[model samples]
Target: MGRKSNQQFVQIPLAKLKERIKQLCGIYGIRYVETEEANTSCASYLDGDSLPKYGEKPDGWKASGKRIKRGLYRSKDGSLINSDLNGSSNILRKVARNLGIDLSRLGRRCLTSVRRIRLWATKSNLTLKNARAFTPGS
Candidate 1:
């Protein structure tokens, strides 16, 4: 049994974050297509010889001021990945905002936080799909 005070809750699903990430990347011509070098077993890419699709990135790609490994700018996509792993939070709020999600009750840790995302999608006449990550597949 749960407390009456905690009757309402919110949580962002992985599928939503995945779709939103793709939408944001799509704005810059970045495709979520996977690269051949990605590890099929783990569903993630390996630091291999080939350049990854959507540029999962590999050696020889000269990085700028950002290290391309952990720099926030280089890892803007990290916002998506992190959110996918951590669920809804302030980071998801930022990423969602970038994708025009326009959620008002962001940064709250609950089991029903996805309402605003759905609402925004509805109000904006947007059709959301289960978007894939910038990851490669078998």
Candidate 2:
């Protein structure tokens, strides 16, 4: 398939997935919020780094922690955090400001201790695999 056609095909299912997520949230009485994830991955939640708007970084702006590789982030305290978790924490920080949620007590250790789950789709069945707990500096 051509590139454009491939993207369209992918988008169709993504739209349906989003709709289904909204429906599930509604059924569970959970609020479905869509927040911009602009600089979430680039900023360090452990260091309380400022999250800049997408493409609007200030002059010489820098975060304390940085992505060391595809899946790892090096924090300011020389600790390693999962890159995905770091980004997710920053995204939560974005909405926490408006929701009055306190995240100051959150620490890198908690992030590293999270259990990772791997999901597999076999034919029409979905299987969940219990991935090992995330170890720091792994």
Best candidate (score: TM-score) = 2
* Candidate 1, 1-138: lDDT as tens digits: 578756776676978888898898899887464223221211211111122344454556542212223211212223222223122232333245346655553332322223333433453344333333333581
TM-score: model 2 vs. ground truth: 0.66
Local accuracy by lDDT, each model: 0.36, 0.78
Error of 2 at 129 (Å): 20
lDDT for model 1, please: 0.36
Residue 100 of model 1 has an lDDT of 60
Candidate 2 per-residue C-alpha lDDT over 42-104 given as tens digits, one digit per residue, 9 for 90 to 100? 888888899888888899998888899988999898898889888988998888867666775
Residue 44 miss distance in model 1 (angstroms): 28
Which residue runs of candidate 1 sit more than 4 Å off their true CA positions?
1-86, 105-117, 121-138
Q: List the residue pairs that clash in candidate 1.
A: 9-112, 10-110, 10-111, 10-112, 10-113, 11-111, 11-112, 11-113, 34-136
